[model samples]
Target: MAITDIPEYAHLTDADIEALGQELDAIRRDVENDRGERDATYIRNSIRFQRGLELSGRALLFGSGNRKIWALGAGVLGVSKIVENMELGHNIMHGQWDWMNDPEVHSTGWEWDNTGPSAHWKHTHNYIHHKYTNVLGMDDDVGYGLIRVTRDQRWKPFYLGNIAYNTLLMLFFQYGVAVQHLELGRVAAGRHPNPDAFKQDLRDVGMKIGRQVGKDYVVYPALVGAVTRSRKTWLRAITATLAANTIRNIWTNAVIFCGHFPDGAEKFTRQDLEDESQAHWYLRQMLGSANFDSGKTLAFMSGNLSYQIEHHLFPDLPSNRYAEIAVRVRALCDKYDLPYTTGPFLLQYAKAWRTIAKLSLPNKYLKGTVDDAPETASELRFKTDPDQRLTATVDPATGRRTGLRTAIGKLRRRRSPVPAIAGQRQAKDVRAA
Candidate 1:
């Protein structure tokens, strides 16, 4: 891809960026060359630990009547599932440890616990999403083709409920992920009329989903209760699985969202990619991603997405190496005067939700960018609305500033000055209509 000509990235010319890419690539090569007994032992031990936790949790659920025991079991099982999906599954499928020459642990050979198949996820996530990063029209991950996370997107009133629906989406996050690759949103919007096109895909994915569901809710519980012929035991096992899955879903969603959508991350239009350069691509990855500040334990849990900048730059690099490169990458960004988007985990979590909440509005700036214009408009700027708040300007169809007239009318009526939307941050140098 031609590097983007965006002036912000001019700090590093195409050649400069290429040299930087070489420097980063050397880091990966070093990790690749050094991969040996230590890496192998680490992964093997992690897997064993996860498996042991899963088994112990299942065993404990047999006597889940003890609230403390059930809590412990569920918590442990959730951690195992999280690690399996985030650290092991995500990294392995990135071909991070493929240098080990171990077939079973290789990206092509390993299967994850999620309902979504690894190959399908790799296609959508690794190939498409990573390649596109934050390109508005191309990247399915920009709001995952769901809620609007940026102001540029032409918004409809439908997004008003995204705050609620997004929560529900998180509750069933794996299910959302399973169908994200299908681009079903396009079908819903009537962009793709041929429903028959994805029939076989549906069957294949359905089987995977079915297998996961059966394992957690059916087969394992059936066996546990079979020995005693106790319906109570079966119910307990089912509940335990539900608990574990819920915890895993919430956590995975939180970590992933925090890395991509938290404050300081910007969204770009497809126009930004015209003649995109390698430097531009690298710049987008850096600017569009964020990290959550965390200690070792939380970093381990996040699959090192807390170092999302490092991961995006060298996706195929082993997870352990990300933390190492992160310090270097941060220094490079600082040298170039680039923004390093990141914050505390809980703080970023709140920002993601705030983004979901505020973006559920008609883009106030849409009039300036989009052709199909609305008649009425206002101008507000964003500064502190958890996420960036809307700042409406004059109507796109007609560059009329009726907002001032309307604001004056409202002032004359003195009908309890419209309490500036609560917790809303007005954009810089912009004001209410």
Candidate 2:
């Protein structure tokens, strides 16, 4: 789409720009001075985090009472992890951990880690993801074997299976990432010889399913009954686990999905990145990344404001600084002629799903289909279908459609003065329709 064709939403005027600058300055001050430290918001967020930790601890200590109860606790815990992954893990990864520096600024196990804020997610996310947001060859965010995250894969004939597999895995996310990462480790170590590197995923996912069955069938019930006959503690543990796991998985999946699978994000091949500069890569991270609302309780409970766009741009910046930089980012985008895309989180999430839907459909372009196939009658039929064709029939004199009843009526019923045709012109109305 052309730049001129972009629908005019709203543009920042010089005055608007100046006001935003002042706002950013004030926010920066509040951040540096920690003026909001004791504010109700801070206290509230602290309480939520503490409660999550406490509940998760309870779940870990005791097993759930029955099979059904255990599943419930596990689901809830997954959701909590989702929230924490976005709010807490993302925030700390973004270095938002400095909001309260009582915790040391160590890189190893800081609050910034995605999976407990360790260095692995940091390296994989910062160095790899940001550096190569959508470039298939380098960015793990895309071709992570079983976890294909974008529609660009559909064009390949072989990618049909990958798309189907990814769909199911997205619903069961925790296992997906864990298994994918494990497979990635094996492939990186030169342990797998399959050219497409799919055997590793099969190996990891199979092992995980086996382990889950082992735990559910043998380990959990046995351990719970053996430890105590009291079912109440088990019930509490069951609920707690479900709560934690549910939050974690949902939050992580949502954040990751929103980052690249929606509007304003690009899917590039190795060729697209070959000529791109470092600044170009940085812009992709800024424009391609998105943000979502953590909601009142959710933000406090989860730590999602970290390493978002600004963090991607400047990894050293603490996570809490994200909200503060938003206004400044708007100004920067205007000044630099960049597109800064922001919206409510869930809305963008729907956009991601829509993107997937569009890509997953049979339409070639939407499916990210790379067409190398020889054209056939069926292909031509879809392409030339009248419903999809573009047609324009217009009046010869005025370049307007005259065949419509309304057009003819307008021509005859108009009270306005009409211009006369030349001497050679016919008296009849000329219809190009």
Candidate 3:
């Protein structure tokens, strides 16, 4: 077989795998031992959030500065807050700041700005989702928003138009920006609650939404357009608003879309939530999560999501630990006959684009009704292939469906395993026989 077309990766020499294993071992050690001072960049990230919040405070002051300048500053503050959300808020919420030992770590100031404590992200992402990895219906990581991430997603209005209506609601995107934490918190809890935390979350969300609308429509324009009648002044105000909003969109969406909506990922519901294996759950975190080859600095800056496998394996471990653990996670996958998924960051980014490109007026799959019944090659081809050759007929010699290779090949290229939509993370949770 041609080198490029090797049926199994084992075609490569054992030495290659061994070398990889050694490297991964080293990585795992480094990640586990990340008890040193906060890296310099992490400090900068903390400052970024603080600066945004500080500026927001100033804008709320309606201070003595030029109105245009204040508006511009407010605009910058808005984008900064969103940036803080992606870079800092998320990290704090994940308990990245646990080492700090300060209660404020979870507060908005530490930039761990959680909108709702009950959102399952705390439970789902940090606890169950990471623990379960990609189990169907059980882990929330595979679904983008409420809609399914896999091709077989049940299309329904709330689920399907999730992005559409959400986009419309967020046209200003600020609505999402303000309260993403609430939804995540809800998802993390996995069920409705009757607690003070949930009640507080409801109140906070209303206030934040009101604040977002005020910032975008009232506070922004009056402070920006009304005071700056000069053409150049008003134009700058508009430019600042657009720039800030654009930055906010790219910043928030990139990390999130990458985390859940990649090609090989799963979308589980209540049914798929059966008992899970530890190893299987870990593998899901590795496979379900994509690691873009963000440069070393950017990876750390991004809180290591570009190296998501490591993060899932060691959520309590700081992001700086990911670079060290990445190799070990890969090696672990190998030792257990699992796939270590990684790629050039941009290539993985295409998966996000494909997700958006495929976005439409929401379908049935979003409503959570995908039948787990075994699917036939014909059905697979109908969903994916235009050419019938994939399902033309089975080859008796191989005892495999005629189109098995083509269908599987498509999934494998996406670096996913058979039972394509299932979580690959279970490897970590399963006990050895």
Candidate 4:
């Protein structure tokens, strides 16, 4: 029941969709043309800052016998890893800084600090995830093939542990990402197409994981133990590294969930991608992604993913430029009367969690119909009455366009006479009917 006709769900005509795409294309061109010194300096500075913080943290860990120093060292290292993973590694591998023609920042050259192989990540994330966005079966990121984040996923007994699964996924997010490309479930079921290729990929992941484990657990701990001549310090060093990696994993998971699984971030069926145009693709990105409010520091920490809508629109654009790009994208959303799905950081993240928690149950236990649920909706929701199907219209008073957002507002009002209960009965009635 996920959206099958995007233009209808968005209440936009073919011409309007094309026009919106043109404006978005223009935004891309402007940013591409304006990429210059400031952008280069920003990335360079980010790299230096991350490296410096990491060194400081490692140095502090040498004195990990002191409790306060151990905590401080772990915290600093965690933040450093977050910055490296989100800002530098993720963006660089997106080809965001490739225009600079600097191999140091090039997508192909930068193997990230995470356990996942850069080559595998590029294929899975940059190519498949971005290209497919939220198309149910196509984008593995739709719950990462673990937890059910949307009702479009048929409920199974396995999903009853949605919250538990998500918590574990959050804690060991890097490992989850590393194994994502392998599709372990398929291989376990003997469904993998190429055994030789799978073996090679598995080797690559194994090597990366070994290197990561050795660097954090063995090499650093052994070095600290030799220098400090204390077994306690060596054990503390390993724990410190563990704490840091856990912090990074949790934070990274939160940011990604906030941008993706929130209420307004709609899912789609493969039918929607059939013969999809550039404009439709842009539209899909807008509808399928969410954002969270953030200041400069928060934005930087999130790799400018606070502007997730814009990032999806122009994945290869300089990450630092997403803030400005968001301004234009929001304006376009206003012009076309589309919803710019965003909210406070905590609120957006909470919504994502709420969806996950609720969707663990079967449809019979849920309140909303498949076509009108908070986490899963389709254009059919607007076609209850064929003569009065919700669509774009012009506001006579202000000469402004009124489309999906306006229609949604009207639908909510119609469903809920009293704000307190807000459509509970109506939704149930609709489901029964």
C-alpha RMSD by candidate, in order: 10.6, 12.6, 12.2, 5.0
- Model 1 compared with the native: what TM-score? 0.80
Output the TM-score of candidate 2: 0.57
- Give the alpha carbon lDDT tens digit for every residue of 66-104 in model 1: 678778878888888999999889989998888888997
Task: Report the C-alpha lDDT of model 2 over 264-324, residue by residue, as the tens digit.
Answer: 5545556546555444445546545665555545444335342256555555444445565
Model 2, which residues run further than 4 Å from truth?
1-48, 51-53, 56-80, 90-105, 110-119, 147-154, 161-164, 182-247, 269-278, 293-302, 305-307, 361-433
Instruction: List model 4 lDDT by residue over 271-317, tens digit each.
Output: 98888999999999999999999999999999999999999999999
C-alpha-based local distance difference test score of model 3: 0.50
lDDT of 1: 0.72
lDDT of 4 at 235: 94
For each candidate in the order shown, give its overall lDDT on alpha carbons: 0.72, 0.49, 0.50, 0.93
Q: Using TM-score as the measure, which candidate wins?
A: 4
lDDT of 3 by residue, 209-328 (tens): 566555644565566445645544444544555556555565556655665555544333343234423333343354456566777656744656777767776666666656766766
Off by over 4 Å in 1: 1-12, 189-197, 365-433
Q: For model 2, where is the 10-residue window of minimal lDDT?
A: 1-10
TM-score of 4: 0.95
Cα lDDT for residue 374, candidate 1: 18
TM-score: model 3 vs. ground truth: 0.59
- The alpha-carbon deviation from the true structure for residue 49 of candidate 3, after best TM-score superposition, in angstroms, is 9.0
Question: TM-score order of candidates, best first?
Answer: 4, 1, 3, 2
RMSD over all Cα atoms, model 3? 12.2
Candidate 4 ranges beyond 4 A from true positions: 385-388, 420-433
